[model samples]
Target: MKLFADYHTHTIYSHGTGTIMDNVNAAKKKGLKEIAITDHGLRHFTYGVKREKLKRMREEIDEINENNKDFKVLLGLECNIISSDGQIDLDDEAMKYMDIVLLGYHMMVRLKGVPSYVHIYGRHYLSKISKSMAEETRQSNTDIMINAIKKYKVNIITHPGARISMDTGRLAEAAAKTGTALEINSKSNIMTVDYLKVAAGHGAKFVINSDAHKPEDVGNFRNAIKLAEMAGLTSHQIINAVKS
Candidate 1:
């Protein structure tokens, strides 16, 4: 299989080291047909994209698209799930500027309120220490993710099993219903072949991404490709892959 587009990439707009143009140039060099500028959402405590700069980013992307007819760049946000009730960090006004949406569970986000904090962060950490809490937390995490999938038009769920435990089988069922693809993130090692198999069994589509934080890594998919192969994934099951 071969990937034609990378839908999860970062730039100076978030915590990435390169500028948007730099990443675009790198993707072009790597022979990618398209790439998305999916910076972290505004709720990320340390690296979220600035709300005031959304218009500027849109203008820059428009200019690039006008000048480069052979390649495409999508403007998107890797939004955070800020609440257990499926609330994300994106509003309708902000959604207007996005071409795609990628949601994920991340630590250090400004959550909705105290209840969200206790359910999302507090219980997550507690599960690591208590075996009993682990199963319950895993169920809660999966349910919350399912709620998000049902509530939004999420194109992809980035690194589903990374940084937190989730019931891959259950989450995949929900994702399949909403046509949301699961990301195989090359930069993170949390997703395993077993998890992929379970998700695939539920008919969940997938996407392999470098989760590139630098321009040079824009289209790197070696690790993700290996995992997908091990899981017996075909191009037809991957949103960005094609027969090679």
Candidate 2:
């Protein structure tokens, strides 16, 4: 299956190895029509892009895309799903610069309030905890993402069931209901056959992305395609693969 766009790549802004222009150039070389530089949110402790940095990032994107009409380089964020209430760091001001918003659970986000504390820190020993507690935490995380989709115009949910505990089936259904696409990421291990099977059964549309941190890795969707094939996913089911 061929990909038309990759809207979930990273650059030096968020611990990535390449620059914004480097990612765009790589996408051009690979014949992709579009790409987005989705840095981590400001709440991420170690590698998050600061709030002020987003304006400069948008400037760079505008400059690059102005001269390079053949490829579109979008400005976006891989926003952290911070609270069980589905409160992320994305705000109205930030949305002005974003063409796509990718949501995922990350361990390094600054946790505040009881909901964030429980899901971000409390989910570590899910297996060791009581069965009821584990189930509660899982449902909470799942609802967080579900509510995130409803609360925000999220384009994709990256790497579902990767590092956090969640009920993937329910998450998939919520995403589908909200017109959000579930991602088949190149780097995350959660895009397994069974995960795709469950998601697809819920009628979730999918987007395949490299999740590339380096320029060279930019349009590489080998792993994503393999998983899709394993789950018997048609190219039509993949949003990014569709001809516009």
Candidate 3:
């Protein structure tokens, strides 16, 4: 299977090694139909895009599109789920400039304060997570995912349960209900076969995204395709894989 469009990727604006044009160039070389430049949102302490950089980013995307009409470069952000209250870091005003919107859970996000951020990192990043704590975190994470889908016209949920555990069945239900695609993320393999099975049973549609940090990895959908196979998913269930 192959990706028709990769909707989640990062660049030098975040933790990625490549520049925006570099990713676009790689996608063009691969003959992709579209690619989205979804840098980490402002809540990510280390890798998030600076507020001042938006103008440059917009100009770059426009310039790339103006020069090349064969491929489309979408301006987007990997928005952080900042609060337990389902608050996301990207606001409507900031999102107006976006062609695609993606939401993901990250351990390093600034959730209202330093201590809260530290607490989040400390809890999820620890070597061992207790079953009860993991279960609680799962429910909370699922709620946040459902809320984000309900509140925004999110195109994709980057990697649910990739860091924090989540109830995949409910998440799949929400994704199906909202017409939002559940992502089979290439970067993180936390979404298990069991999780995919539950999700598939709920009639959830999936999108396989490279989640590529480097330019050359733009169309690498190997891991996602392998995972989907384990879940007994068919090409009809994966949006991008249909063309492949």
Residue lDDT tens for model 3, 1-244: 5557788888999989999989988887876788899999988889989977987899999999999877889999998888665778888678767888888888777797565454455555542456556666667668877987898888888888777767888999999999888999987888889988888888899988999999989878888889998888888888776453
Q: Put down candidate 2 lDDT per residue, 158-200, tens digits, no spaces.
A: 8888888789999989988998999899887776799899889
Ranking by lDDT: 1, 2, 3
- Most lDDT-accurate candidate: 1
Cα displacement (Å) at residue 122, model 3: 7.2
Clashing pairs in 3: none
lDDT of predicted model 2: 0.86
**For candidate 1, lDDT tens digit of each residue in 31-57?**
999999999999999999999989999
Candidate 1: segments with Cα more than 4 A from true spot? none
Q: What is the C-alpha lDDT of each candidate?
A: 0.94, 0.86, 0.83
Model 3 global lDDT (CA atoms, 0 to 1): 0.83
Best by TM-score: 1
What's the lDDT for residue 66 in model 1? 95
Error of 2 at 180 (Å): 0.8
TM-score for candidate 1: 0.98
Q: In model 2, what lDDT does residue 129 have?
A: 67
Structural similarity to truth (TM-score) of each candidate: 0.98, 0.94, 0.90
Per-prediction backbone clash count? 0, 0, 0
Answer with 1 or 2, whichever has the higher TM-score.
Answer: 1
